[model samples]
Target: MKMSDKKEILNSDKAPEPVGLYPHARRVGNLLFLSGVGPRKRGSKEIPGVTLDHLGNIAAYDIEAQCHSVFENVRHVLEASGSSWDKLVDVTVFLTNMQDDFKTYNEVYARYFKDNQPCRTTVEVNALPTPIAIELKCIAVVDG
Candidate 1:
């Protein structure tokens, strides 16, 4: 394989920079591994579509908005590595409240991955960065 065949690393100015010690995604061979993305906007802690209720009940956040944020992050990762959603193979979603959020999550997820829904698994977790509800991670095939 020519040196040009080497994997490319991607970062999008529109997406949040990796907060810890990692890049948004890394290319190895023909695969792109995207790290978990949250509702927080890139380079900031502002949570889009988040709202609160005055009835002593936390008004539910917009699952679709969160989903869109995740997808945008995914898109940046894929493009950074010269890939697309079509090349995705698998996804894993970490939910702080799967029971209440799965339906909404699926609704938005279906919109982006309508044709070929990649293999995926959703699991409930104990905590997340903030009051945000869900996060998603993905692995995709970078077609040459």
Candidate 2:
């Protein structure tokens, strides 16, 4: 099949707009690849659980809140792409402060993927495009 015939762009109003030039997710054949998802609210720049100083440095943040928002955003993207949490195959997580936040993030993540846990890799990153505590990039397989 032609490339165009096997791919499609996915978007959801429930998720925030991409920080850069990209769709929320793209489906190639039956696999859906989601862009990095931050905790920013849909249709707004407000990031839950984030508190920044005057200079925009993170003063205090709640990793649990960020995790919930990020997963909710991922859920919206998955639903838009004709998939669901159970269909997720893999997840790549990025954290700004792994030492301080990994435990809380993991606790919240376990609540989301309690039964159908996807293969995951979590890594510490210097920063994210936004000032959020965490971000998630995921892949899922859609039903034919």
**TM-score per candidate:** 0.83, 0.94
Query: Cα lDDT of model 1 overall?
Result: 0.79
What is candidate 2's CA lDDT for residue 128? 86
Supply the TM-score for candidate 2. 0.94
**Residue ranges of candidate 2 with Cα displaced over 4 Å:** 2-5
The most accurate candidate by lDDT is: 2
Candidate 1 local lDDT, 32-142, one digit each (tens): 888777777876766677775665333768777887887887787777777888989999998877888889998888888999789999999987766677887889987
Model 2 Cα lDDT, one tens digit per residue, 46-114 = 899989899988888888888989999999999988999999999999999999999999888888899
- The CA lDDT at 78 in model 1 is 77
TM-score of 1: 0.83
